[model samples]
Target chain A: MNLILAPVRGLGRATLAVVSAVGRGAMLSVDAGRSLRRVDQWGPHLVPQMISIGVASIPLALFIAAFTGIVLAIQASYTFVGTVPLYFVGALVGKTMILELGPALTGLALSGRVGASNASEIATMRVTEQIDALESLAYDPIAYLVVPRVIAGTLMFPVVIALAIAMGIVAGWLTSIALLDLATPQFVRGLRLFFDTYDVQFAMFKSATFGTTVTSVGAFFGYTCTGGARGVGRATTRTVVVSSMIILVLDAFWAATLL
Target chain B: MSIELKDVHKAFGEKRVLRGFTLSVERGETVSVIGGSGQGKSTLLKHVNGLLKPDAGEVWVDGQRIDQLEGEPLYETRRKVGYVFQFAALFDSMTIAENVAMGLRRIPGLSEADIADRVRTALARVDLEGVDEQYPSELSGGMRKRAGLARAIALEPAYLLYDEPTTGLDPVTLSMVDELILRMSDRLGVTSVVITHDMESAYRISDRIVMLHEGRARVAGTPDEIRDSADPVVRAFVEGRADLLEEAS
Candidate 1:
C-alpha cells in the first residue's frame, strides 16, 4: 500500500507543478500581450535586444548548421548507395535542412544560449528587487523588460533560421562535391527538382513559434523566481529544459499540421 | 499624501507576515517602522504604494482606497510614491544619469532638457556630484545609496518609502543616510515612511516610531514615548534586551 501510494503522490505532485506552470505562463502571456500595446515604451529596447538575441546568435547557428548539413549529406549518401539515384541525396539534404534541422537545431541551441541568459538576467533582477523598484517608479516591468525581449525573439528567430538554412544548404553542397564525388550542377539540379517554397514558409512559422515559447517561458520562470542565487540558477536551468522541450513539441506539431 | 493601513493581514504560504497590522502617517510626517527580522516592516511599507495588496483589510493613500486599484490607477498612485530598496536596487546596466532620468522620463511632457536638468538637480540634492556617467557598481556603498536617493528624488514624489535605508552602512554613511532622509522630508515636504532595525537612527530621523512585534504594531508614539514605554516587548526592543523578548515569547 505504501509503495503504490508513494509513486501516486509523486506523480500527482509532478502533474500539479506542470499545470501550475502552464497557468502562470498563460497569465504572463496575457500581461505581456497587454504591455505590447505600449509600443512607445518598449520600442527603443527592441533593436538593442535584437542585436543581443539575433545578431549575436548568428555565428553559433551558422557553425551548427554547417556541421549538421555536412553530416546529413554524408549519411544520406551512404544510405542511398545503389538503392536510389545519387543525385537524390541533394533533394534529401535540402528538404531535411530547410524543413527540420534548420529551425529545430537552431532553436535547441538558442534555448541554451539566449533563453538561459534571459532567465538569469531577469532572475537576478527579481532577487535584487529591481523589479519592485521598477514597479515603485510606476514602470510596468513586463512592458519595459519582457515584451521587448519576446518581440525581439519572435521577429529575429526567422532571420536566424533563414541564415541557418542557407548555411546548411551551402555546407551540404560543398560536402557532396568534395566528399561524395557528386558534380555541383547535379546537386543544384536535384535541389531544384523537388523543392517547394512552402517548406521555407513552414520553417519560418515553426521558428517564430519556437521563439515565442523560448522567450516567454524564460521570462515567466525568471519573473516568478524567489529565494535568491539558488533560485536564479533553478530558473535558468528550467528555462533551457522547458524551452527545448516546447521547441521540439512545436516542431512535431508543425510538421504534422503543415506537411 | 497621508498613508494608512487598517487591519491589514498578509501571509506567504504557511507563514504569516502581517496579521491585523495597522498604522497611519499624516502628510509631511516622517514615521519610522522598527521591528526585528521578518516582522513585516518592509511588507507594511510596500502596501502603501500598492506594491503588495493585503490579503484582508484596506490600504488608503490620500483618502483613496488603493488596495483594489490596478494597472494605470495603481501606477498613478505609485508614481506619487518613491520606494528606495535596501540595496539601492539601481539598474546596474545603466549610468547614474540614466537611473535618475528613468522616472522623470515616465512623466508626460517632460522635455529631454528638462529631464537632464532634473537629474542633475536631484543628484546635487543628494550631495552626489560629477558621477553621472558612472554605473551603480562603480559607486561606494554610501554613494550608491545617495544615487538611489537621487533616483527617487528625481520624481519629486509626494511620499517616500525607505526599506532599511541604513542597513550595512558604515557609521559615517549611516548617519549621512539618516540626515538625508530627514533633510529630504523637510525640504520636499514629502511624507516619509522608513523601515529599519536601527532604533537609534529611527529615533533620530522619525517624528514618530511604530514598533512591530510578531506581525502586528505593538506600539506607536513619539521616539521618547516609545523609549520610555512600559510594555516589556517595546522595552526589550528599545533597550536591546534579548532576555525580555525571550520572556515575552
Candidate 2:
C-alpha cells in the first residue's frame, strides 16, 4: 500500500525554505562586507534604517514589558500563595524576569515589529530588482543589505531588553507593593540576593544569541521571498512566526543549560 | 579581445532556455540579439558575468574561460564585463555619486582622488554632471537609465551587455539611448552585446543583428542583409506579418 506523500512534501518544502533563507542571509552578509567598501554610498541610508529599527523599538518594548510584568506577578502570586511563604515572591519573580522572560519576551516583541518590517522591506527591494542593481555595480548585496540589519539587531536588542527588564521590574515592584501588600525593601533585597554575578552574564549572552537569530532569520526569509507584494507579506508573516518560535526554543535551551 | 560562447546550454528542470547556443562579439563591435521574450536573451547576458552558470558548455572572455573561474578570479572576470538591465535598476537608496563610485571602490592601488576623478568622468560621460548628490528616485526615466549606464561603465569594462536598453522609453528617449549606446561604444572601444526586440533600435545601433529562435542562432548578418534576407523567417519578422508571428509562436 502506498502512503500519501502530502505531509512529507510539506515538511520538505518548509525545510527547504528554512535552509534556503539561512544560506541566502549568510551569503548576503559576506556580500555586505564587500559592499561596505563603498560605505560613502550606503552610509546615510544605513543610518536611518538602523535608527528606525533600533531606536524606535524602545517604547514598544517598554509597553509590552509593563503589561507582561503585571500579569506574571499576579499569576505567580496566585499560584504560590499559602504553598510558599510570602518572602519567596521577590526571589521567584526576579529569577524568572532576569533569566528568561525578560530577554525572551523582548525578542518575541521584536519579532513582530522589527522582524516583519525587515523582511517586507528587503523583499520589496528584491522584487523591485534594487538588490540586483547592487550586484551589477559589483557591490555585495548582503554586505549592503543584511549586515546593517544584523549590526542594528545586535546593538539594539540588548538595549531594548535592558529597557524591558527595567520597566518590568518596576511594574512588578509596584504591583507587589500596592496590590499584593508585600514589603518594599524586603522585595528589593530578595531580588538583589537571588543569584550570583554569573546570571547577569548568562542573561546578556541569551539576549545576544536571540538578536543574531532574529536578524538572520528575518533577513533570510525576506531576501528569498518570490513573487511580489503578496510574497513579501507572506515572508513577513513567516519571518515573525519563525523568529518567535526560535526565540522560545532557544530561551528554553539556554535556561536548561545555564541553570 | 572579444567575448565568445562555445556550445552554451542551460536548462531549468525539464525545460531548456538555451541549447547549444554559440555566438561571438569582436573587440569594438556592437552586436544586437533580437528574439521574442523568454528566448533566453536575458539569461545569456547573466552567464557572461557568472551570475548564472550554464548547465553545460563554456563562455570565454578575451582568452579566459569564465565558467571555470571562482572567488577573486571570477569577481575579477566580472570586473571586465558590464551589464545594464532593461529597467534602470539603480540602487534606490544610494545617491547618484555613490552608485557611480561602486565599481571604483574595488580598484586596487587607486588613490581616493583618482577614484573620485573617475566617478566624475563616468558620470559626465552619461551627461549626468552635477546630479551626483541626487537619489535615483529624483531622476526621470531617461535620466535613471543614463545613471544605470554610468554605473555600468564606471569600472571601464572592456565588454558591455545591454538587456532591453530601449524597451520602456518614448521615441525621443529611445533615440537618445540609442545615440548614447553608439557614442559610448565608439568612445570606449568596448565590445557590446545588446539584446532587444526593438527592430529600429537594433538596426540603428548594431554592427550586426542576430535573430535568435528556439534557443539557437537562426540568422545573423548585417542590418541590410537581415532586412533583405531571402530566408522566410527573416523576411516574415522584418515585414511583421501576423501569419508569420502566429506560425513562429
Candidate 3:
C-alpha cells in the first residue's frame, strides 16, 4: 500500500506541473495578440490540410455511405419480404444513413485523417521550439495557433459531413435503382418517411460535438508535448487512436440517450 | 531600474540547476554571464523574465517582485523585457519586416504607417534595413542574428537578455554582433544581460562579467577584474580550458 501511494504521490505532482504549464500557456496566449497573425500565417498552410482532410476523403465518404445504405436496404428488404411494401426500403436506409451512419462514420474517417494531421503538425512545431518562439515574441500559442484551428474544425467538419451525407444518399439511390430495380418514386417516398427534421438535428449535433472533441483533444496534446521528434510522433499517434476511440464511444452514448 | 536575484534555487527532479545563486545588475548595465553549458546561465536569464520561478528566494525586476506579478501585469512586465536566443530565433513564418513589427503592433493607438516606420528604423539599427521582405531562412547567419536583435529591441524594452548572441557566427560576423550589442546598449540605454561561452565576445561587449559555476555566481566583476581574478574557476575559464570550452571554440 505504501509503495503504491509513493508512486501515486509522484504522479499527482507531475500532473500538477503539467496543469500549471498549460494554464500558464493559456494565459500567455491571451496576452500575445497575434491570433489573427497566426491565422494569416496558417491560412496558406490550411489549403493543403483542407485538401487532405476534405477533398481526399470525398471518394471514401461516398463509397462507405452509399454501400452502407444499400446494404441496410437489402437486409431490411430480405427480412420484411412481403410484410412491408418494397417502397419502404428507401425510407429505412435513408433514415439510418442520415441519422446514424453518415455523421458517425464520417466523423470516424476524419478522426483518422484531419485530427491526426493536426496533432502531428502542431506537435512537431512544439517539439522544435517554434511554439516557444511564438511565446517569446508575445504571440499567444492558444489564441494564435490553437483557437483558429479549433474554429476551423468546428466550422469545417460539418460542411464535410453534410457533403458526405448528400453524396452517400445519391450513391445509395442510384444503387437501389440500378441493382434492385426499385422505382425512383418509391425510393424518394421511402427516404422522406424515414428521415425526419429531428433526426437531421440529432445527426448534426453529434457531428459538431465529434468535430469539436477531436480538434480540442488533438490541439491540446500537440501543444503540451514534451521531449522531441519521437515524443511528437507518439503524441500524434496517441491523438489519432484516442480520439477515434472517444468519438465512437461518445457516439454510442449520444445515440442511446437521444433515442 | 535594476534586476536582482537573491538566494535563488531551482531544480529539475534531483538535478539542481540553481543553488543559492545571487546577483544584481543596475540600470543600463550590460552584464555578461559566462559559464560552461548546463551551468544555469540560461536558467538565470529565464528567472529575470518570469519564464521560470525560483524554488527558494526571489527575483526583483525594477524593484518589482517578478514571481508575484500575475496575469495582465506580468504580461505588461514581460513586454518591457526583450530576449534574443542563440539561434536568432526569428519566426520563420514571418518576413523580416513583420518579425520586427511583431511587438510594435501590440501597442495601442499606433497607426499602421507609424508601425511601418518604427519597423524600418529598428531594422536600420540592426543594419538590416533593406531586406525587410526576406524570410529568416533567406538571411545570412549574421543577418538573422541582427534581425532577431531588431525584433528584440522593437518594443523599446527597458531590459534586454541575450543568450549566446555570437554562438554560431564566423569571427567577422561575431565581431559585428558584438559591435551591434555594444551600439544598441549605448544608443537605446537598455540594460543588457548576455549569456555566452565566448570569452572574447564577452570581454568586448560586457561592462561587467558574472561567471556561473555549479548553479551559483562564482565570480562577478568588471571584465578586467574577471581577467585579473585569482579564482581558479575564473582562471580556467579565461585560459579556455578544453573541458570548460565545450563546443564554443
Candidate 4:
C-alpha cells in the first residue's frame, strides 16, 4: 500500500506544482498586460531591448538555420534519389524551412539565448533587491523590467525567424547547386511548384507566438524566483527548458490546427 | 506624526514576521530599528515606504492609509520616500550617474541639464564625485552603498529608509554614512528610519531606537532609554548579546 501510495502522492504533488506555476504565470501575464498601459516607462527601453534580444541573436540564428538547411537538402536528396525527382529537394527545403524548421528551430535557439538571459537578469535583480528598490522608488517594476523585453521579443522573434527562413532556403539552395549536381533553374522551379503564401504566413504567426512565450516565460520565472544566486541559475535553466518545450508544443498545435 | 504603523502584521507564507507591531514617527524625526537578523527590522522599514503591504492593520503615511493603496496613490507616496538597501541595490547596467538620475526624471521641469546637475550634487554629497561614469560593479562595496544613497537622496525625498546602510562599510565609511544620515535629518530635514544591528550607529544617528523581537517592537524609546532598559529581550539586543537570546529560542 505504501509503495502504491508513494507514486500517487508524488504525482499529486507534481500536478499541484505545475498548476501553481501556471497560475503564477497567468497572474504575471495579467500584470504584464495591465502594465502595457505604461508605455511611457517601457517605450524608451524598447529599441535597446530589440537590439539586445533580436539584433544580437542574428549570428546564432543564422548559423543554426544554415546548418539545418544544408542537412535538409542533403537528406532530401538521399531519400528521394532513385524513385523521385531530385528537384523535390528544393521544395522540401523551402517548405520545411518556412513552415517548420524556420520558426521552430530559431525559436528554440532564441529561447536558449534570449529567454535564459532574460530570466537570469531579472532573477539577479530580484535577489539583489534591485526590484524592491524600483518599487520603493515608485517605479513599476513590471513596466520597467518585463514590458520592454516582452514587446521586443514579441516583435523581433518573427523578424529573426524571417531572416532565418531566408538564410535557410538560401543555404539549401547553395548546397544543392554546389554539391548535388542540381541547377538553379531546377531548384527554383521545384520551389515555385508547390509555393503557397500561407506557409510564410503560418511561419510568421507561429514565430510571434513562440517569441511571446519564450520571453514572457523567462520574465515570469525570473520575477517569481527565490533563494539567491542558486535561484537565479535555476530560473535561467527553467526558462530555457520551459520555453523550448512550449515552442515545440505550440509548433505541433499550430501544425495540427492550421495545416 | 508623518509615518505610522498601527498594529501592523505581516507573514511570509507560514512564518509570521511582524505581529501587532506598532510605531509612529513625527516629521523630521530619525528613528533606528534594531533587532536580530530576522525579527522584521527590514520588514518594518519596507512597509513604511509601501514596498511591502501589511497582512493586517494599517500603514499610514502623512495623512493617508497606505497599506491598501495601489497604483498612482502608492506611487505618489513612494515618490516622497527614499529607501537604501543593505546591498546598495543599484542597477548594474547603468552608470552611477544614470542610476542617480532615474528618480529625478519624475520631478517636474527637470531638464537633462538640471538632472545632471542634481546627480553631480547628490554624488558630491555622498563623497562619490568623479565616479558618475563608473558602473555599480566597478565601485567598491562602500562606494556602491554611497552611490545608492546618492540615487535615493538625489530626489531629496521627504522620508528616507535605510536598511543596514552601514553594514559592509569600513570604519571611516561607516562614520561618513552616519554623518550623512545626520545631515539628511538635520540639514535636509528628511524624516529617516534606519534598520541596523550596529547599536553605536543607531545611538548616534537616531532620535529614537526601536528594537523588534519575535514579531513586534519589543521596546521603543530614546537611545538612552533603550540603553538603560531592563527588559531581558531588549537588554540582550541593545547589548548585542546573542547568548541571552539563545535561551529564549
Top candidate (lDDT): 4
Clashing pairs in 1: none
What DockQ was computed for model 1? 0.88
Residue B215 accuracy (lDDT) in model 1: 85
TM-scores, all candidates, are 0.98, 0.87, 0.83, 0.98
What is model 3's interface RMSD?
Answer: 2.0
Docking class of 3: acceptable
Cand. 1 Cα-lDDT: 0.91
| Interface RMSD list for the candidates | 0.7, 1.7, 2.0, 0.8
Candidates, DockQ: 0.88, 0.42, 0.32, 0.83
Report lDDT (Cα) of residue B103, candidate 3. Answer: 76
Candidate 4's displacement at residue B212, Å, is 0.5
Local distance difference test values of all predictions, in order: 0.91, 0.81, 0.79, 0.92
Candidate 2, B1-249: lDDT as tens digits: 488888899998798999988888889999999877798998888887777789999998877888887656776777888888777777777798887777777667888888889889888877789999999999888788888888888888888899888887778778877987898689979889999988989999999998877788889999999988887677777787667767755
Model 2 DockQ, alpha carbons vs. true complex: 0.42
Chain A TM-score per model, please list them. Answer: 0.97, 0.87, 0.78, 0.98
- Give the per-residue lDDT digits (tens) of candidate 3, residues B33-143: 998788989889988988778899899997789878764566677778888867776777789998888877666688999989989888887777789999988998888
Candidate 3 chain B weakest ten by summed lDDT:
B240-249
Among residues 3 or more apart in sequence or in different chains, the pairs in candidate 2 whose N, CA or C atoms overlap within 3 Å are: A28-A142, A31-A143, A32-A142, A32-A143, A32-A144, A33-A143
Output the lDDT of residue A105, model 3: 87
The number of the candidate with the highest DockQ is 1
Ranking by lDDT: 4, 1, 2, 3
Please, what are the lDDT tens digits per residue for candidate 4 over residues B88-192? 999999999999998888766889999999999999999999998999999999999999999899989999989999998899999999999999999989999
